[model samples]
Target: MDIPVRAHIERLLDAHASDGLSEAVEQAFRAVPRHLFIPPVALACRDDGPQIIDRDADPDAWWDAVYSRASIVTQLDDGATDIRAGSGDYTCSSSAPSTVADLLQRLELAPGHRVLEIGTGTGWTAALLSHLVGAANVTSVEVDPVLGAQAASNLAASGHAPYLVVGDGALGCPERAPYDRVHVTCGIRRVPYAWIEQSRPGAVIVLPYCPGFGTDHALRLVVTPDGMAYGRFPGFASYMTMRAQRPQRDQPARTDADKHHLTTRVDPRTIGHAPAGADLAIAALTGLDSLGQADQDEDGPRYRLWVSDPAVPRSWAVAVWRPGQDEYQIYQVGDRPVWEEVVAAYFRWVGWGEPGRDRFGMTVHADGQEVWLDTPDQVIGSEARSAC
Candidate 1:
């Protein structure tokens, strides 16, 4: 192994001790070289946004970024825009070293275990999986053809050739069925029934479950003999939504006359800045998604909270709060009472002793998914609805 690459792996291990990077996973990272998967010109990950790193312009800087703990953005706007431009919706990336290790640790992969990888973005993850399990036991699927071709090339260059399929990853590769483990890279709102049906009885599936609420969660599920998968959120994660599961929400443009103004004693920030457990309960109870935006103008700092039902195009509500105000004003204009629904969910969560995210779990079945608390039988909502 190269000294510089070894140094990077050591640094990642030291920094991410709390991430629970197992010794086997650390060895996999040591075996697979990170630089081989990244492009010459791409965006380096940042807290605010990604920045460009061009190998031709600055080899030292590019090399530094390639080995850093940060993720490198490989494609933007689904590769329609050049990566050098450095400004577009992030569509593809070589995931950060810490994120890779964290998810792989949750996977609990063993030697010779059959694995199915969803969203083979840069193929780095697939290559690592091939190293952990034999290349013959690994099957990776990518939704984009161009990315799929490039991933195939990257895997070959790295001296590992796993089964790569260019198709919708939402529909897991059924040709190679009964996998022992399923690893998903993209964030998904709905747990596809195809995955539950394709895996073995005791197979484990790990993915980032973005419920379109306050925060997203990293989910780990175990398949049962009855064709259902049950799991709990391990922690928080943010990732690009699966192409087929992207939310197409509509916030209707409205005039003052169209809006119905109401006032509430509950602070808008309470619901806007709620914890992950409350977020999950609210989404399951109401079947709605929400976002909070904070800004400062001449009138000082203000918070704007928007809630909507993605299924109902014209259904939405906004709650506005300004400093030094005892009560906030809510302007709602839609068929569904989104604000009311949120308030009800918030109180329900508070009544449940304010449970944390770990206390909540999800069960995915053929018709729909259900969110439960503590035990699988204690379901939160009466109706099963997929989180939007």
Candidate 2:
């Protein structure tokens, strides 16, 4: 690990080595050179470590960005617009090293395993997978023609030749069916039948599933012998939605109610119940398929979340961030009164814990995102339908 490339991956591998995924991740990291994957962009290495990048700043900031924890939005709307101008609705990216590590941990890939990666952004993940199980054992798909070609070059430069395809990922590549594992780099509102169909019996499929709401939760499922996959939320993570699957949500409705008030605009009838704290609010909203954040705003940190859903709106619960700063209030309203749903869902999630996101399983049918939780084999709407 002497060269810039070696050092970049060495640091990444070190972070996860203690976590049992060290070997698979190390092989993958050692196999691919991240600098080669990020084309034309000036290479910047940070002394603090972890090759995360912030592509928004000048040359001086690029080094810090690449090593930081935040994801550098690679393609906005699948390379449709300028991210610098704030319209690059994220499509693909070189995800932060830790996130990639977490996803790989969820994947649980073993030696000699075959894996299919949905997005080849920077070809980093695919290269890592290829390294873990040999390049011949990996197949990667990218929707954008340009990105696909670039990834091919990136993979080639990294000394691995993963079969890269320029096509839709939602329709997983059939030629490479019966894969031992399937992992998606992009966020998906709908889980594709292709994944379940192509996965070999007992194969594990890990992906971020956005059930047509404001927040997308990571789903790590295993293909059962019967062609069905059941798993639970590994954790909360978000990605730029796949190009064809971006939510077509209307702007959130604005209520005349005061931002710092108890009165909600939605009918009280909709309020089955609410909880006593922000944690419960966050959990319930997330249980409603909405992800919520509950934290004390200490030190006045600025946090921004990107969203496009009317149902799973976004808001802030502001509080003092200093010593003896205990007063807290909800400032929810505007186009998206996100916190409203948080309070609304807290009551529901407080109860859903009876079973849990894990207890809720997926039974793929020919036409539905069929899922039921301790309940029966109830059919559910596709991610798109749920948004509507």
Best-matching candidate per TM-score:
1
Candidate 2 segments whose C-alpha is farther than 4 A from its true place? 15-20, 42-64, 83-87, 212-215, 249-262, 265-345, 352-361, 370-388
Give lDDT for model 2: 0.60
Best by lDDT: 1
- Measured against the true structure, the TM-scores of the candidates, in listed sequence, are 0.93, 0.70
Worst 10 residues of 1 by lDDT: 379-388
Cα lDDT computed for each candidate against the true fold: 0.88, 0.60
How far out, in Å, is residue 61 in model 1?
Answer: 2.9
Which residue pairs in model 1 clash with each other?
none
Local distance difference test, candidate 1: 0.88
Per-residue lDDT of candidate 2, residues 116-229 (tens digit): 899888788888888777788888988888888878877777788878888899888899887999988887766777888898888888887655434456777778887777
